[model samples]
Target: MKYSAIITDIEGTTSRISFVTQVLFPYAARQLPAFMQQHASEPAVAEQLAACRNLMQQPDASLDAIIAQLQQWIAEDKKATPLKALQGMVWQQGYQNGAFTGHVYQDVFDALSRWQQQGIKLYVYSSGSVQAQQLLFKYSDFGDMTPLFSGYFDTRIGAKREMSSYAAILQHLQLPPKQVLFLSDVVAELDAAAPLGIGTMQLIRDGQVAGSHTIAHNFNQVEELIA
Candidate 1:
């Protein structure tokens, strides 16, 4: 209630889960192999590949091995930073080719604008890479909503369900946890934030209850709570 920063999850909270599971994930999975093959020599692509190798603890990993491991991670939706970074690259191609624009609920865009005007800083915390998060808002259904956000954080900091990640974010934001509101559809994520004294809001977009937290069915309800 006293927060100056509002951090939110992307999939299922700000955007429909279907857009991620059905559209975004599938597109990334389908295009990853080809994208990697084509850009393997590029510095950015090689950097992510090296990160993936480091994650796998195979410092001398070959490109083919890294690619195969990344595919496995993609299928599992692993929140590994390297996997997410690679997915962002593949998804960039999809976005550029007009596969699909990011999907966000109408109410979300309106509420975000209102909150921005009220001086509450907005940030995103997602399993998706920072690049992917930017792409989502930049190419959002509402068009170019990236400016609404103050910053983005991804798995590079730590896993979403880890309390340490919340602590790290608070440190980075230079704000006390009590003054930061963390929103997510997952109760475990809220649980992680709550113990750190961060305010918690559970987004119940699908009408499913999984944890003990304040639940808002839509961004309108969220706006009222923050107000």
Candidate 2:
């Protein structure tokens, strides 16, 4: 393997963005109202609600108002940390109840298994909360692919497009930046990582997105880049 560590994004890289927009987002939006209403008193649930209120600066916001703000955030696909945390809780129920299995691209499944077998450390860096990331892979269509990942990261570290986030990841990995490769569907994310001396590849799965980073149509192509 060309790198000792590889960190990849989720949406549009390993999974279709539509599954997120059409399936997961809608599922969360639809169930969030109920989840919020039902679990407002639980400490963990209450804390995120309080955080949402803090974000909204409406300290006195009623439960209905908080629910409305969360739904609005979901509609806008806002990457608010509190929103991601709440959605992860909601998705946990949905996955356990067999509402929907997480979607993983066929190529991604194959490539991830192959790369792991080759002794390359694999990690995930997604905007989705770490709990949500685990749920997706734990109940994934390919079934329990969570074992493949050595660690997971989310926006709690920093915004995905910020250079500091990649720097933080490198610090945690305790490796030279060049020893790591970052794969994502977004050019700006690749741009952020590349400057830190991380190998970068953009997964152009939808036939869109051109960038200065190396481009791959699928994980197989990504493998070719590294090999």
Candidate 3:
């Protein structure tokens, strides 16, 4: 394999944008109010709520107020860490309840399985929380694909558009940047990885996405590129 490790973005890369925008986002948003009310006293939820409070500079924000703020964040699609964490919590229930199975492109599933068998380590780097990433693969439309990944990363390392995050991921993976390919639909993310000497691929799944990185319409094309 040209690359020994593959770090992929979730939305718009391995997964469909609509599944996230249309299904996941709305489901999480709708559940946020009741979910918060039910779990606010729990340590995990409280910790994230505290972070959300700190972010909003409302150290003593009421639960109702906080839920409203989170709803606003959801509406704006802000990549706030607290929001992502909470969304992950909500998604866990959805997956367990069989509300939805995460959508993975057939091509992506086949390519990922083949690459894993070939000894290429697979990892995920998404703005979504690591738990959310796990949940997606754990209950995917293709069934449990979580075992295929070596690790997962979220914005906690750093913003995806920033080069330092890719540097941090390289450090964690203990791999040379050239041997790690970062795939995403977003050009800015690919650009960030590229400067750090990471192999990069842009997934133009829906329409044209302007970028200098190698472009693939689906994972089959990505497979061909690396092969």
Best by lDDT: 3
Q: Residues 78-165, candidate 1, lDDT per residue (tens digit)? A: 7888888888888887778878999999989998898888898999999999999999998899889998999999988888999999
Candidate 1 Cα lDDT to native: 0.89
Q: Sort every candidate by lDDT, greatest first.
A: 3, 2, 1
Question: What TM-score, over all chains together, does every model reach?
Answer: 0.95, 0.98, 0.99
Mind giving the per-residue lDDT tens digits that candidate 3 earns over 5-100? 999999999999999999999999999899999999999999999999999999999999999999999999999999999999999999999999
Higher-scoring candidate on lDDT, 2 or 3: 3
Q: lDDT of candidate 3 vs native?
A: 0.95
TM-score of 2: 0.98
- In TM-score terms, candidate 3 sits at 0.99
The residue-by-residue lDDT of candidate 2 on 132-209, one tens digit each, is 999999999999999999999999999999999999999999999989999999999998999899999999988766
**Segments in model 1 whose C-alpha atoms lie over 4 Å from true places:** none
In angstroms, give how far residue 155 of model 3 lies from its true place: 0.5
lDDT of each: 0.89, 0.94, 0.95
Decreasing TM-score order of the candidates: 3, 2, 1
Higher-ranked by lDDT: 1 or 2: 2
RMSD of each: 1.4, 0.8, 0.7
